[model samples]
Target: MDAIKCHNLSFQQGEKCLLSRVNASFIAGKVNLILGQNGAGKSTLLKLLAKSQQPSSGVIDWREQDLQTLPLPELALQRAVVEQQQTMQFDFSVRQLVSLGLEIQLGSELVKAYQHVADFDVVLNRILQICDLGDLAERSVLNLSGGEFKRAHLARALAQIWPLQQTAQEQPDFSGKWLLLDEWNAALDMRHQQCFASLLKTWCAQGLGVIMVVHDLPLAQQLADRVLLLKDGQVFAEGDSQTVLQKTTLENGLQMQLQIVEQSDGKTMLLPKF
Candidate 1:
């Protein structure tokens, strides 16, 4: 099923257009990766999809419902967004920051009820464990390393959609939810990146649709089930990984000389021209 559909979407700032005539469909249970050069409007496209910015023209639909028309609370229940940069002015603890999702999703009364029965603490603990933030739960968010902060925000995003209150008696599933991520792996080392990738795969398996903007070509190639190449504020190429990610497409879209190598294990690697 398609989680989101963008038709002839365009965005502009003053007289300069950032995205023009963009069309795409993000499918459920798949990782939709967007790639582009620095000023190619990848971030703009993500903001548009997340409804943080409105398009100058065209339409975006979530499950065939008009996206812009949905109430903010309604939209929040169905989708979560993790932006490329996050700035917090307050000295919030890491655990408090992650718990914000519960506040947003379940409100005080429901969150309290869930904690009473299912134990939201247990749920939060497992989330922190997966994001590798178990040890830093009480630390101030301002004191964390860059990688740690990113992982903390990722846990928060996941918490927004995770059915934390579901017990063994309830039917367990994650369906009709979407995660829009912008450069989520930008701060991570290889180990954390792989850990996040594995977590994303598990979520996708449970039917969460994810759309991410990433600069790491090889990592994108490895994790994306589908890819969209953006150039000059428009889609340059888009399709399955093997179709949209290729030597010629990357060279043209990124305006760089690149080499694609096939390893003995049949995995592809992308390297820049020397």
Candidate 2:
């Protein structure tokens, strides 16, 4: 019943139409992957859904509540966004940066009474461990390597909605909680990428809705419960992983011939057919 519903979603800048009349719904307890070739509006859609950009002509409703009507604090509790760009002008340690996720308007008395402080630490610590930032918790985020910086932000976004059930109860008006990411794993190494995938799987299992823009087709297939393939600023194909990931759709969406190979281990690999 709780879901993000979009209607006639369109965004424009000057004369360019980034997105046009898009309609879809992203439900909880699932990993929704958005895939498209460069400039196909995948990142733009994520921004609109994250409320970082206003849709030119559309409505985004989170569990029947219009997204634009919600307050900033309420929206922050309902959704956390991780963008592709990472930057911090000021010096701040990883732990301090991650702790900013707890800046919501919860009463101190209620927080203490509900045992939120302890639960918050549990969520924060787990995110740090998952992102492999326990060693760098004290390290300045600005000085960390690119991969480390990316992981720190990932941890922060997850921390924003960590112990999601409690946060939902604390902010009942924001029931359709979501984690929105734009190419979040683009900077990670192979091992870290796999680790990140595992971490997201664990969160989705706990009823957290995840919508991410990704370029890795194999990774998308492996993790996505649903896939939305965009082309020319519109929905080219959308459905379960198996339905939207066909070779034809991949070729059409990407504008290149691709060879899909299946391994003995039941994994699908995408190869450019030269």
Best-matching candidate per TM-score:
1
RMSD (CA, Å), each prediction = 2.4, 4.2
lDDT per residue (tens digit) for residues 1-274 in model 2: 8788889899999999999988888888789999999999999999989888999999998778898998777788778999999789889999878877754534336454455455666566666876799999999987999989998988888777765355523422223568999998899999999998987787677677899999887788789999888887898988898888888889988899888788899877777788
lDDT of 1 by residue, 50-147 (tens): 88899999999888899889977888888899989998878999898998875566654654644543467777777787788889999999998888
Model 2 stretches astray by more than 4 angstroms = 105-123, 164-176
At residue 123, candidate 2 shows an lDDT of 61
Q: TM-score of each candidate?
A: 0.93, 0.89
Supply candidate 2's per-residue lDDT for 250: 90
Clashing pairs in 2: none
Instruction: Tell me the spans in candidate 1 whose CA falls farther than 4 Å from its real position.
Output: 108-118, 168-172
Q: How accurate is candidate 2 locally (lDDT)?
A: 0.82
What TM-score quantifies how close candidate 2 is to the native fold? 0.89
Number of colliding residue pairs in each model = 0, 0
